[model samples]
Target: MRHPHPLPPPGHAEVRIVAATPEAARLIAEALRRRFAATEQRSYPAGGEGGTRLHLTVDTTHTAAAPRPWPATGEASGARRLQADEI
Candidate 1:
């Protein structure tokens, strides 16, 4: 039989990465591979406008390495921490 909606198996997660460029989407997928057991990424056009969409299936039960923490506000990484109001 066929189902309109399907779910990933237990301990597995489906991740979709959308970015302005294919390179950006690929980079994000690579980063996720470093943290989890993930399948090779599959990419496709996002919409009428130019954009990239990458899909990956990751095994949450396994960890390749300890997850890195997001950079704190004003850190050298140049990522600004969002305040509650901004969210």
Candidate 2:
């Protein structure tokens, strides 16, 4: 099995985009490519779940969201869009 937390090769950075749709993921990747100059990208199907995400490898430092928040106690009322520092 693939390691859950694989490190990027030296001098490269990885960025993951978890979105509700493949188009959303592609848009995010395109935006990042314009800004960060990503060198590589791959999209992964999230199995039975209804979303997709893209992993981008860039030649620069990448920032990730802070640790995810504790699970909500009940059904989610609405989507939560969070920033990197507000994870």
Candidate 3:
């Protein structure tokens, strides 16, 4: 079963994109909006600087499906395990 909140424990994944212009950033943001369904984008001026920064947030809980292999274990399981050798 999947919880109402389907998220990894808590960490960050960094991504790099080639968005050299405002139009390119808008296009990239639009593409992400379609893919994630629930997404929000905002732009704000930084301090006294003349440049604007874009912020994006995505919520995937509603679309995430239930997990398979209820109790993951053993060799055939999809979960990762720490072997004695590694320990």
Candidate 4:
């Protein structure tokens, strides 16, 4: 007899990376935009400073299994697994 598969955990992993310059920040945003189906970008001012802040958001639902579907491409699949070294 086959055993039933365990239920996958709830929730998702949120990845955030802050940079010093707009250029560097955009680089990350662009990368995420190319990979994730749902990506968003927002700008905010840095308090007591002149430079602005960039926020990049990526939805990882496509990469989750069970209740969710897997990514169509390998590039998108790779984005799901975040290495400890990358953190």
Candidate with maximal lDDT: 1
lDDT of each: 0.89, 0.73, 0.51, 0.56
lDDT per residue (tens digit) for residues 8-74 in model 2: 8876778888988998888878766765657667889866888997888875554333344546755
Query: Please, what are the lDDT tens digits per residue for candidate 3 over residues 1-87?
Result: 877844432332222234445565667666555545434567665445454455665545443334345354456534678878886
Runs of candidate 3 exceeding 4 Å displacement = 1-18, 45-52, 63-87
Rank list by lDDT:
1, 2, 4, 3
lDDT comparing candidate 1 with the true structure? 0.89
Which candidate wins on TM-score?
Answer: 1
Q: How many residue pairs of model 4 clash at the backbone?
A: 0
Looking at model 1, report the run of 10 residues with the lowest lDDT sum: 71-80
Better of 1 and 4 by lDDT: 1
Misplaced by over 4 Å in model 2 are 1-6, 9-11, 61-87
Of 2 and 3, the candidate ahead on TM-score is: 2
lDDT of 4 by residue, 1-87 (tens): 665854333433344556767776677776666656334677676556655577644566553223434455455423467657777
- Estimate the overall C-alpha local distance difference test score of candidate 2: 0.73
Instruction: Judging by lDDT, tell me the better candidate of 1 and 3.
Output: 1
Clashing pairs in 1: none
Task: List ranges where model 1 is wrong by over 4 Å.
Answer: 1-3, 73-87
